[model samples]
Target: MTRFQSPFVRVCWYLSLAILAVPFVFPFLWMLSGAVKSQTEIFAPTLTLLPETWHWENYAEVFSYQPFARQYFNSLYIACVVTAGTLFISSLAGYALARIRFAGSGLLLLLLISALMMPEEVTIIPNFFLMKWLGLMNTHMPLILLPMFGSQGVMATFLMRQYFTALPPELEEAARMDGLSRFGIFWKVALPLSRPALAAVGIITFLFSWNLFLEPLVFLSDIELFTLPLALSNFTDAYGLPLWHLQMAATSLAVVPILVVYIAAQRQIVESFALSGVKG
Candidate 1:
């Protein structure tokens, strides 16, 4: 049976939620409004939610001002590649850590968790030099390779490990009895049952790779090769001031995929994290 909250309590809960939601919602609303407003209207002394004149053309200008379509594709393809790579590498490593009996597994897991505590900024300088030596600068290679093997990958591996740890060992034993190889059990049984965790990891990795700025800025110098984040910053005047309207329009487009992914899989993400934490 379901229990319903009292009217007064429900009202108070709704009010509180509305208040809490304002900070997060306001920026998106402002960005949408700003995308259709001119510089003069945007900078007007009096704050207004709606533009006096709707410059819907700003969206069209976003493409005209740069190779936005190419940059968009760059971000999209890179994110997809990174997400795919992370899932494969992290799942194999995580399954090993959780299931395989090996010396130094504990130490390796500890070191990985420690690596998560270290911020990417700390390693950016060394990575920049490394990429330069490897001649991967001014290309998308660093953007794809770094995130696939870096902290984001580590986090995904940790999440997968926790989830895999929670599964019953009997399943694998049964598979083994059926003459399934270790990899066969993982590929057929374990992987199929781990959809929630995989979705969570995929969404997180894609967003991380999509919004990545520091890596792209460091590794890529060519505007033609820039990702969305780097390309967003290129929407500037001769004086390097942002052209706000077009920037906002481009940003609005950039955020659409993120919003769609989150909205669609928000429940899965929450459930996956909760399960992993409790099981761990």
Candidate 2:
């Protein structure tokens, strides 16, 4: 009789897989559990995989607790705008850097690299003063403008440049032969083939905007103008203590849809990032 793989090896492999998955999977599981669980149940030592007493009211309460719907829309539209702007700005800059032969191209790349390596906190103070001087203080303008021109945009631009640099010159030459301008070839042919890079930029930018805390915290005070992350943190009592139930529910609201999309397109989504040079 032909030998078959042992149950022992299969069990060991499955166990190993489960162990590896815990770090990624556990936080989500906790969020979901915390969303539905009561204040008391959330802190239980054993941990509740399922809600012991499901408090479905938390979902409604999440909205009732603040201007959550408005905040949700704030984060949503900001993310969309930021993502689109980054993709447009990054891709164009990237193509130019990759294809054009201008003086100081290397120096420009160096400056961009420097900006990318520098942490946002290091610049936030000066940026705050700058925003104040420009009359952009306590507005969405800082959130939008800072990121659009900041290291994030630079990173996206570099990613696109790298991707563009890898494309064949023959295509551009063929486009020229076919009476297409450089802009036309770059816009039509190159961009059409660069959908993966675009998707990567869009997704990363969206997540960045969605999860942004420090900028919103420092710049915003109006309840009506708060983004989701800032709004979620605002669910505290008069003593500056947290209201965990509402916070978790709000967090679940903000994060779950993103998680859903990520799971649904895990392969294509992941490949896009990996292709764009952000391996994780």
Candidate 3:
């Protein structure tokens, strides 16, 4: 029988899903509700989903308190650059590792795989020094370069490599028979068929760069260079006490765009993963 034919089972499955989703869904709901609440209402002894009175001015104050617009732009642009760079570098490396039968190619793939086991915290000190030595501290260069060359990029490369390895050899053989060079086959044939993997990589890389906090915290001190995560932490009074209302408002604004994009492209994201999984 079809799943829909069993009403009791379907109800139980959906009910279980709803129960599991509460923890994840409620926090966002509370954040949205809290954004419009006054400081008094936010920390009130009694909890309510909607505030007693909505304080809309909290959003206006968020922008005035810091170089928020500039910081927002910094994050948006940095994430875009990092995503594009990761896609190009990872796809090229992945394709080569998967398709080319060169000396030490297996060893190179093994080394790259080993990198995934190393945590970012272990490399932070060396990376910081490297950035400073290169005069990249307090600049967007480290932010851009680190994610493109770091563990996240390695993960993307492996993902693409898996996807590429699963592709049928006949396609490349056909292209080769047509007298296409290796680069031409990769550029014109393979890459064109790699849209799903590319989308998966781009989405993941973009989100990683967008939500990156530790790298920005260590490399950047200038407010103008701050990404969203760093900027969100700056919502505080002179006494270093958090301006909770303003912070919530700013966070809501920052989160909404990503939420919108995710909601809109969720189907594509799922499809990409499915395609990658099937191929891999």
Candidate 4:
């Protein structure tokens, strides 16, 4: 048997993986432990993985500290909208770019690709002015709209285009023979088959929107409209020092959805990346 197939080798390999994972995993373990620790304990010179005193009330204080629950909901709903919007818009655009022949299509694709290189920091000022002109300030509108058209959206389009470019043309041709219009073929045939790409885009867009900070900071001034990232910062003293216990607790809670999403869709994420990379 190959060395990799041997039980001893397998055990050693797994152990090596565990050892390698500690640096990445320990912060999360520390975060969980620190969530239940007091400020004094958290900043204590001695490194302790477990809390000397379990301050479970810090979790409750997370809600009482600000409009945290509303902020959480804001992040959640915005992420869902951005995810859905990116999927719908990106898929259609990707399909057209990948399969439909038209003048200037190549130029359009090139332009979109160029957009991927332009960081949001460069455009944030222009977008901020535009949103101000439209009277969208102190609202979630910018948060929802900007990302759907920005780098994340373009990346989704590129990924979808790549995936669609790699699909079997025979299936679409067969659908056309059945009296299916282009939209019908796309809606009925191509999209369903592109679930991996869609999932990848959806998950990515959702995460981006959920963790968004800059747009929300610029566009929103209302505490009630704050997303989790901003709200997390509010767990601070008037002197600007973080309430370590409460902040840790809030951060722990804020991270739960992300953890759940990554855990559930990790396999699909890896698969989607692999398939999307095949054509590009």
What lDDT does candidate 2 reach at residue 154? Answer: 89
List model 4 lDDT by residue over 2-43, tens digit each: 865798888999999999999999999999999999989998
Q: Per-residue lDDT of 44-80 in model 2, one digit per residue for the tens? A: 8885689888998999988887889998998888888
TM-score of 1: 0.96
Q: How close to the true structure is residue 31 of candidate 3, measured as C-alpha lDDT? A: 87
TM-scores for all candidates? 0.96, 0.91, 0.94, 0.96
Candidate 1 per-residue lDDT, tens place, 1-280, comes to: 1246577788899999999999999999999999999977889998998999999999999999999999999999999999999999999999999999899999999999898998999999999999999988898899988898899989999999998999999999999999999999999999999888898899889999999999988888788898999999899999999998889999999999999998998887677567557465
Alpha carbon lDDT of residue 225, candidate 1? 93
* Worst window of 10 by summed lDDT in candidate 1: 1-10
lDDT of every model, 2 decimals:
0.91, 0.85, 0.90, 0.91
Global fold similarity of model 4 (TM-score): 0.96
Weakest 10 consecutive residues of candidate 3 by summed lDDT: 271-280
TM-score head-to-head 2 vs 4, winner = 4
- Misplaced by over 4 Å in model 1 are 1-5
Ranking by TM-score: 4, 1, 3, 2
- lDDT tens string, model 3, 91-182? 99999988999999989989998999999999999999999999989999999999999999998998889888988999999999999999
Better of 2 and 3 by lDDT: 3
Report the Cα lDDT for residue 147, model 2: 88
